[model samples]
Target: MFDIYLPIAGMQFNALILVAIGFSVGVLGGFFGVGGAWVVTPALNAFGFPMAYAIGTDLAHIFGKSIVATAKHRKMGNVDMKLGLISIVGSVIGVEIGARNVMYLTKLGIAGPVVRYIYMFMLFGLGIYMLYDYMTKDKRAAAQAAKVAAAARAGLAPPAKKSWNLPPMIHFPASGITISLWTVSGVFLFTGYLSGLLGVGGGFIRMPALIYLIGCPTAIAVGTDLFSVLFSGAYGCFTYGIKARVEIIAAILMLVGAAIGAQVGVTAVKYIRGYGIRLLFAIMVILAGISVSLKQFQLNTASQWMVMCAALGMCAVIMIKLYQGFKKEQAEKAGYAVKEVKP
Candidate 1:
């Protein structure tokens, strides 16, 4: 069972660590409707795994986790099968190009810095934007509510419009919106490229894009994102595996843990509101950005402690999110009981 040792590193197989990492990633993945590959790849790299092996192993684990999450989301009627299928073709092509670029960068001895820099920029930028958006939205909601109250005091009704005026709009029975296909395709292309470049499941980006850009409801965005990730991640894993880039044992161990974690995450989703999900996701991304930035420092300074710090920070974020999710679930249940007693 421990036959495949890392001769260069002089380390034996540690199945327990792999399982723990997988389980943690799975919980985050399910809760945020993400693939969790971002967490897995960096964590593995911190453990002294080569970049190629880490990415491949992470992909395999994501493939399995995606399957579980997608199934759950599908049951909840969140998946848009047609859109997911179309996105798969684009995701496959993007992954191939991105994987090739990774190999090229590795050969040039610059992959680590380049990847870390990209991660730092993307994560931090997105995190800031999401945080800003949430804050502005809260203010806007408060203003709107106040306006409505004033109108009631004046004996006038609030606005009756339940829609907006967006051009070239077409109705989506699933989303119940008249959004443009151009908007959808543009988002998917970006999502596909990001998934390929970062070796992530792309749900982190896709969920927001779907809700904000495409005007899908939060539940639909989460569900549809999982459907897209299921295919995209499987394709990525297969491509990497065929190239012998995958570590099957590591991937399997992570998947085993992720499977259980995914279930817990999915259950927690029932209790979390849309704004709450966005806030949690933004916080996670910011922490992830910090972790990747620390990794960049490790690479530049050749500091083992920095690398360990990055790994610990990331794991801490995951664990915190998981605890918060469970807490939210419990709070919701307690609220229900209080409501029942009130009546």
Candidate 2:
């Protein structure tokens, strides 16, 4: 009853697993403002899905998830439509080129090892950097708060605003900052290519790039990233679909769960601090890196059990992130109520 392709016992898959994985990835994606395709693609591959089918199905699911998350983030006043639109154009071109590149790599018989190694190195490096940044930010915030307290006690004015003199800066009405368009375009181009090459929606990289490089606030970055993903993912889905790489049934099932999870994730963001978000993201990415590394090892050794274990480990990491985010949200709410009553 739950099977999608039962005619071929060796290759048939259960629908329940697809939905569950989708739901889990969706929650993480929404909360972290990422495509979650990294987790989805590998998970599908591990489950006896062909590489092409997995990429296509993952993109389709990402398109749906991105639409839902974008709407939610827009409602929260987090998206920058103009920036997102510009990024989309670049992303589409990049995806096309990336798809072609992947095909070329496959022909050369170097796709698997190259992709796996790149994923491991990039994921691990980014994860470590994020964790370190989160820790340092927390410490800095504490120190700043103490300084502000000391100044308050002394009845002195706060520090003067720092100034920079630069011309040709364009104003972003949404961000309330004047920045160079060159910087923005460069980021978009890089993110676009990465999205295309990795078969991801690019939210993971785009969101952070917006926040750090473009200097957009976290909420704005989340919204804008989702908006960009909406376009990129749709294009990705269509491109891969035309190649007969997508699995419509699998995509639909995953989307069903992801859409709902996205709403929950968007809501959760309001209750968590930015550092908290970074910390969770770091942990999840690190776990994902570990899982991928394990799978690579398993493939080298021809260990079926190890491969399965690695897949399960990835799922567990995602679940852990959800639980932690939920717990943090609840704690924040309780703390807020307590403070309100005391005051």
Candidate 3:
């Protein structure tokens, strides 16, 4: 069904399939501030991509996609450069350590299963937890609103800082917060370690961690995560490039699709509510878990079907959301124009 050249993955792949995969993952990466390697690598492998080339090609595309997404997000005032740089520093160190550990595990002959199981557990557990959080989000929002009212009535100062206050505090003007350096480093290091070990951009982990742990706004979390992914993906590309795993031609095609998809996704973010984004993300991850499980059980065909369907389904939802959002935004602008003219 496809053709290949040495060190190049599926040079003759169904061009539509490759483009679709690239576009879908690009949208996800833009929306979630991740490189989407977790999805792309597996999808490529399922579609006859060389195992070695899959990851490298995925990373190569990710680097390009991240650039597109980050640039757009930056214009939208979503990126926090200070936090992003810190993430890079911590993640780079963590990645080295994690990679070394993986090498050690590989020597024991249980590395493959161990890594796969860990990936599965993380996906399922994170999915469930996010779903639960989404279900209870309204209650939490109401409680916070009540707290704000009570504070206003009491004439108390706005909420006090509750950050852990570990040493070496760093302030981020863009994010409008100050956090302990230790907390920042520790969080990025852990996420970075996961990235290296799992051969992912760690956007899933980093984005969630940014929202819940670092306490960044959802938009900022997405932007900052993408910034970090750019660096990590570049490093990955280089590593795999030296090993002759990166297919430049395939990566170029994917990059074109990703560029367009990233714009759609970044624009959609402006229209969607934070909770809505979280809900969609939870569903996507849960389905990803099912796909991974199928793969783990040696049901390659089933795994591919599940993943492709899930991805296509989710992509449809995102595009629809983006369309609706664009329409609504446009209507509001038209109304504003009419009002100004009347006055």
Candidate 4:
């Protein structure tokens, strides 16, 4: 029973449905270090919200949800405040430049198709690369695991350290990394430009960049990306509010659910490994690419259905993984408790 008056969307909807959608996306955002607006906007549109209102309301809720998730990550020592702040500065400039490019292309009367093509290329390229990384890493991890096991059996020491050792290095204490300043700037600048060009929160792009480019641990990348998402989402909320596109009542309802989901998602990250996150994220983004391609072909119904399925399907998979990990941890704790009881 959708029954809430949303002034901006100019409609009534089941508040619980909004909450459910928010919760699903919130889990993804918290776990994957993205704003998950790509999931949210289309889901809302499926529920009959005006496209503009859907985007605005989703961003508004994302601002609040990011706050919740970021605070939790900070406590977990996952967030690197220095890196996050620098990212904000670089991204803002990048976003502006990206926006300018869009405007220029629009003037050329080929903006829509061009943007769609870029979007398709970016998603497909990133997804394919991540998939490749995951496959290659499996072989590497297996070899390393075998070597370590053999060493322990033979009473030999562990492997030697190899340094990245890039010059003009900058240290992020929270992420426990020292990488080149140019690398950091270039990463954020490119991600920010993509955000501006695609009119997105850029969490998905930034999260991968943090992992593969800057070489942050997966957990830290999730935390740090959420930190960036917080500011970006807040800015989106404010901008949409001024434009009268945000539906406050609906957004508030969604925020309630998002808060809870963010907690679960963040906790799930503790249980999952870096590889697991990458594999799932790669799959998710590939689905998103399919959605965009469908849209480009003017298959409107197919596009919406594809995105909704991707959003919901991915959310379900995340929740199941979280639950499985949580149960395993609980069983381990129980075993420890029994052992400590000593007959």
Output the number of the lDDT-best candidate.
4
Candidate 3: which stretches are off by over 4 Å? 1-11, 148-161
Which residue pairs in candidate 3 collide?
Answer: none
Which scores better on TM-score, 3 or 4? 3
Model 4: per-residue lDDT, tens digit, 212-317?
8888999899999999999999999999999999999989999998988899889888888989999989999999999999999999778888988887788788
Work out the TM-score per prediction: 0.76, 0.77, 0.93, 0.92
TM-score (C-alpha) between model 2 and the true structure? 0.77
Model 2 residue 155 CA deviation (Å) reads 15
> Residue by residue across 176-268, what tens digits does model 3's lDDT show?
888999999999999889877876778998998998889888889888889888888888889889998998878887898888889888888
| Predicted candidate 1, C-alpha RMSD | 5.0
Put down candidate 1 lDDT per residue, 1-343, tens digits, no spaces.
Answer: 5335544334566777787778777777776778876667766776678888888878888889989987887887777776667566666666667778888889999977787787788889888988888879978889899989998999999865465445666567777866566666666777767666775677777788888777777777877788887776777789898888887777787899889877766656665677767777787788778766765665533333443354345445555665787787789999999999996
- Sorted on lDDT, best first, the list reads 4, 3, 2, 1
Residue 268, candidate 3: alpha-carbon lDDT = 83
> How far is 280's C-alpha from truth in model 2 (Å)?
0.8
Listed per candidate, the RMSD to the true structure in angstroms reads 5.0, 5.1, 2.2, 3.2
